[model samples]
Target: MWHTVVGAVGLVMGLLPHVLHHIGLLAGTAFVAGSGGTALFGALGLLASVPMLIRLYRRFGSWVAPAVGLLVFAAMFSLSAFVIGPAISGAEGDVTTPSPAPAVDHTDHPGH
Candidate 1:
């Protein structure tokens, strides 16, 4: 019973981000645009998976532990992409690229 609930929660939690991204509310391109509430939603979705992770740990023991870690990492990445991606995109103009250095005229140097 609880397992089913956990599974349902996990499924919904995992799918919500994809749905938002597909709908264009979440950041799919720019990072900062989705860095607001959408990022929070994604983080909440990951936190909601803790119960399912516990269930998995009990069922599969140590073997599935790594998988759980990977899931957490994936969740963090998704949230970061949605949140940071747009902010970075918006800040692209603030980043200054290095200009090419001018050639020195060595012919006028005493050591030349």
Candidate 2:
């Protein structure tokens, strides 16, 4: 029960920043990316832990509950790193406008 609740909370925490970003209320793209990463890991952690918890309760009674929790947190301890993939920085630096050509020196030209 505790593990499920914690997982759910983590998922919600991850989703909030994204929701704000999607609605245009938030600025920085990095934040959105971070939040997305958090959500993925949290949700996955929750999913992976539930079955473990159930199995622990059935077999080890109270002895294995802590272990199950540790496993769940351990799984979550890094989805932000491996599972989320590399961090995405903001837009690349590329000029939108072309530079103007140098003006011809017609005034000094004999032909002019």
How close is every model to the real structure, measured as TM-score? 0.37, 0.33
- Tell me the deviation in Å of residue 54 in model 2: 0.6
Candidate-wise lDDT, in order: 0.64, 0.61
Off by over 4 Å in 1: 1-33, 63-69, 72-112
Tens digits of lDDT, candidate 2, 14-79: 676457567554453444455575565556666656666777777777856857687757665664
Q: Would you give me the overall lDDT of model 2?
A: 0.61
Winner by TM-score:
1
Tell me each candidate's RMSD, in Å, in order.
8.2, 9.0
After superposing candidate 2, which stretches have Cα over 4 Å from the reference?
A: 1-32, 63-68, 79-112
Best by lDDT: 1
